[model samples]
Target: QIAQESEPGLAVYALAAQADMYRWRGDHAQARAVLSKARQLAEEKGLDFEQRGLLPVAEGITLAESGEVKAGLRLLSDGVRFLEQRRAKRELARARFLLAKAHLLAGDKPQAVGELRRALDLAEEIGTHQFAVVEGQHAVGLLKLGIAQGVAPCRALAEKVQQLGGLGAAEVRTGEGAEEGAASRLEIYALGEGRVVRDGHTVSSSEWRTAIVKELFFYILLHGPLERDAIGVVFWPDVSAKKMADSFHTTLYRMRRALGGDVVVVEGGQYRLGDVDYWFDVEEFEALVERARLLPPHAWQAEDLWRRAVALYRGDFLPEVQRVWCVPKREALREMYLEALVGMGRCHEARREFEGAVGWYRRALEVDELREDIHRRIMHCHAQAGRRSEALAQYHRCREILKRELDIEPSVETKGLYERMAGKGPD
Candidate 1:
């Protein structure tokens, strides 16, 4: 009620929680009614919450109980898929547990067991046991299974359920277990466009408190576990040490609040982000390129690795940021991207795939437009493809771009290639 009166944008969460409680009590009508309000409020107010997925899940379970089993099951399945895509592990585990109950009630013991096992595994992996409702639901399912499938296999499950019954009164704790549960699985892309995708949702700049906060995020990621002093020196170089400390602490607090406290941990006079599993596009690009480089040119996997690396280089690292610190790293990644592209082109050239070779070389030219070497390669590919006019056109395009942009002509090798393509011979 307070949420509805004071902060209505958050009211949908309370409604969803009430609906889950109703569902736990087996009051299908009340569950559905609460979910209806939640869905309506969520739609009307544009409220985004992690618990929003619970509405569909609870509704599906209610429908399954009221004898609309197939429709209910379908909704349940869809809800699970949706939550999984959202990376809502807690919600997904609950949904799976509910689906298991539905399966057991419908007399599909094997399917019920399968769903229960999946729910348990996911819950354990996420390190959360807050769902006593889910545990009760699971226990009930296992009891049914034990009756039908004999006592031996479900003995341990029965024991687990007994343990879960006492955990309802447990306080929601925050340290390692909770941190693991709440830590967003991030996929950061800093290679080209900077994107911080947390749990499959791309965090918009609007979500940040300030540009500095966002930069701090990338800064910590780029240079991990820096001391408070070192960080101050880099970002607040002009400020006094005491002033820098105050500003740094304030910024750090905001970062922790915005990105999760566990995500930015301070310890032993230094700060580092939590050990969350993350995939950085730049790291992946480098790994793929390194692997590709290690393989022989004719190796089947080499071309695929090189292409994957090229695809990952979306642009220069954090192109919008003009910090002095970002310059050398950005240039290094650009060079790595170019190397992968050129390597792929050469690999295709060696395989007698002239058109494929030209495609990659052209891609390289798109990044480094002044690369007369790639321009020469494109001309060679066009000539080999029997399009002499296009070959000649590519040479002229290269020559014009160089002259217009740099007030310089193509190199000797480029000129030689142009002459050969012009049928004036290599001399």
Candidate 2:
């Protein structure tokens, strides 16, 4: 009360923060009241745009989560445009994240994906994590997406986010509560073959009529609801425009018929896998990883998550359906797999279980034997277990791989580790 009386300017921000806290805790009525009071206080204090502009964005997201999509979106869009006009680079990431999450809660995953991509781009453009760790859900989603899209910077940031224990607020699930109750009728596996099991029956490749039809369906299910133009370019880049359009409609129609009328849906100008009783292995695998990521670093649960994640990978993503687009996603998931293996090793090492750590490191090397760091870890683990001979042998293997694969010598650190492990140099 004293601070409010002495500094109403500060009081406005405090009130705004209080309102946001209420909103996150499912207290919409209290959030609205506090937000209104904050806005009123801002106005009474004659706060300028810098001090008060984002209040509307925050308020819009709050209302949207409370069953007012259009009204909230209108205000949110206006606020975003205001930020755009001022070129508020950093703030745009947070604003767009809020916008994307609102779309997610509104049952617009396609647009949510688009908005999430934009937010990640904005963060990338500024060369910052952009407070992504705090944005847990969207930021981590982008990290996973960006890696699949082969956006190199996302890897570094994603690693930081994972190590720090992923961050985010509770999801706003309105229609999704109903979705969660539906019995999953479709089992779509993209990890190995692009396999589909529909209505308790496996869909054979010959059932698609056209060779590309099943592939098209798999593409949409895994990476869409994509724009028609975007889909056309990926599938039929050289075909005439009219032919591409015809093939697209035909494929889309077959996708819906074979999957179901409501499966492949068009909404908000994008073709999406609608609210269906479906399960994708990729989603499950990523979910396991994310749940583990949410735990504290070196916590016991993370290694267990890696075990499930490794078991679920089966093989490279969509290997039977060879498409240009599948490569990055395959690599991205493989990258995550490698990281998980290393994570397991780190967890074991943290517990002073050196031999077990070496085992996980070897598994990572099996995936990509050229990883110098994993080799170093193996050496360190062996040395810790008082196995100087094994440590020396692993170093030689690392040096040979470097020479054979990339034709480069080991880094100074790697050599130093080997020397220290062999007790042939200063510890």
Candidate 3:
């Protein structure tokens, strides 16, 4: 009442919050009445945007609570879209969360899960710029409900939200170890081969009950946290959403059971593996490369960092996993590995260690045989070492590889190197 007496906007916000509480308690009539009053007040004050934007969300939740699922969902969707168009991300996230609630009330578990995931993602995104622990708490609640109802992925999501909320609202930040803020006790190797080592002990693959469970575990590791729907699309592409959801839950259960409860943490709709401290080889590799980048280009320490980073790539990333999703990540990691090799080569070249530089350049070619730039470097290294014939031969290999693979000749850069080695300037 005091809010209403003071600022009309404050009263509107307060009324909306109250209506939300009423809806949560299942007092649909009271929620609707309160929201209607709020709407009326906003309308009287010409608060069209607030009335048009936020009131619909409140009324939608009220309608959903009253068992008007279809009508409620429609209004919620429209209201969310309206706010989305207006770039009101916080309001959109809130509306989506409410829509998930409506889906649950409507007995559409799959849809509810999907909507909840979207809400959580949106909330996490918003939390990056603004603090919103309330959204994290709501995600935790919904995930708990999912667990109670026997949805497998929720267990991990609940843990993730708890962690995000625990480390303050900002912890929901994605990418580059947001959940695993500090170094972790769990060490996983997905580069070359896939392995999960706890402490110092390597977990045997034989212990994984099913291949799908193992695949699911690595998939989450590679992609960080994932939503149930996304897991469905990737792992069970041919199955219906309902069937895939069931299969995904079953696999997730197996994942929790096999790896331990804290192995994977699901935040809202995504599954991640960072309840405790954990380490992934690929992540470490990337981190090492990133650290080297911070040093001066010719810094001597970079040689060691690049060597250590390049050495970590035992083979192609997750070669055992034949999923198409792994391809891009594998390619990306391979490129990073090759770049590390190039960095090491450059470091050696700077020191005039021609043999060592040639070794690194040749190793780079083994990974990416089509690198004309590396070929050029190798030729330079041979020429510097007084291996004039070997230098000329290296240029020949470059020309042949380019011709056969790309059906194109070597770049003018390579031809110029050969001409310089032969004591003939370009015409």
Candidate 4:
């Protein structure tokens, strides 16, 4: 309409709008084309800010949605800088929201949550509903925060999303979602080099069959080596002991065949993963957490290491494996995983990555809200970052939770942290 009416300014707006529509429809190519045209038109009209800010923002969204996430993030960051210089808060919010979405898609939950919170604040300030966008971002952010902070809000957000009938609805109810979608034809990962096979042809697939063997492989990869007896007891608990052993052997045989002979080896009657250069998400997660823990105290790389680790923990290990025996191990590993996440958030806090640290801490609390140490850490992170009111509020929340759930008082450590924040001696 703008083009037909010869309204060049409106034409730019129209192009941007069209790009967004295409992006929402998942037609990233069309979005990119529209954004490119908008960029050329903005330059032709000598609209410096629009050329630098609007064009790159649109381009970044298109690129990220199209799976070129790193490139898209770079472009969006540049665009955000330009918008910031112009004091364009609304545009900046939109850019940040888009960047957050890109990060979430790339499995960088901490970064995504930070950006989402920033966008939320901006959106609220502008009085824009942005409910759809904000809600989705908040849902994912809350879930990640829950994993790090041991808080209930993350799960609550997830539940809210399901109540509203969202993509994660099933996940909220069952605590399991569909595995990550198959990689697109052009998809590639930097960590591992291999072609995904589909129908006996390498067409760039990502569908790993979620059989019992595959789940066991993932479990071993995450928790590291398990005895054959323990594995059978956990996964095949309903079957008789003799039958379970046979099942284990059969499963292992099939897994070896599917994953290739060299992927797993039995040693001393315990199954262990073999020498494989390929990256499994769970293995990457453990390595990242270990690296973060090994980092010197107050090191800047600690947060980065933790971020990488948390990103790989997409969900609970073998979420569908729901036998009673499996629950203990799964929950135990989840608790340990949450602790590692809390450690990462503390690292981020030491580096003054306040929002990032908050994200991590929140995720930990989501996993286990009863951990007093995490509550204290969150309070300290908030206070040290100059969010004193939020810090105090966190203390109050801890007090309330302790009172309501455990019928106990805050620990000396937690009280001490809060007292210091209040400029008083520990109670």
What is the lDDT of every predicted structure here?
0.71, 0.71, 0.72, 0.64
> Cα-based RMSD of the predictions, in order?
17.3, 24.3, 17.3, 27.2
Greater-TM-score candidate between 1 and 4: 1
lDDT of 2 at 296: 58
Worst 10 residues of 1 by lDDT: 169-178
- For each candidate, give its TM-score against the true structure: 0.55, 0.56, 0.56, 0.43
Best by TM-score: 3
Q: By summed lDDT, which 10 consecutive residues of candidate 3 come out lowest?
A: 174-183
Question: Given candidate 2, what's the lDDT at residue 8?
Answer: 78
Give the alpha carbon lDDT tens digit for every residue of 296-351 in model 2: 54787887887888888888888876778878888998888887788888889989
Strongest candidate by lDDT: 3
Residue 91 error, candidate 4, Å: 78
TM-score of 4: 0.43
Candidate 4 lDDT by residue in tens digits, 131-169: 433435423433444334333333555565666664365
Residue 323 in candidate 3, Cα distance off native in Å:
0.6
- Which lDDT tens digits does candidate 3 get at residues 1-427? 6766678888998998887676544445566778889998998888866887898887886665443456788888888888888989888877877787667645566777677667767867776412223443433434544555544444455556567553233222221222111223677888878887765667675656577788888888767777778778888899788567546655664454345445665566577865566777888899999998777647978988998998898999889888798899889999999999989988988888989999989999999899988998999889888999999999999989988999999888888889988889744
Please rank every candidate by TM-score, starting with the best: 3, 2, 1, 4
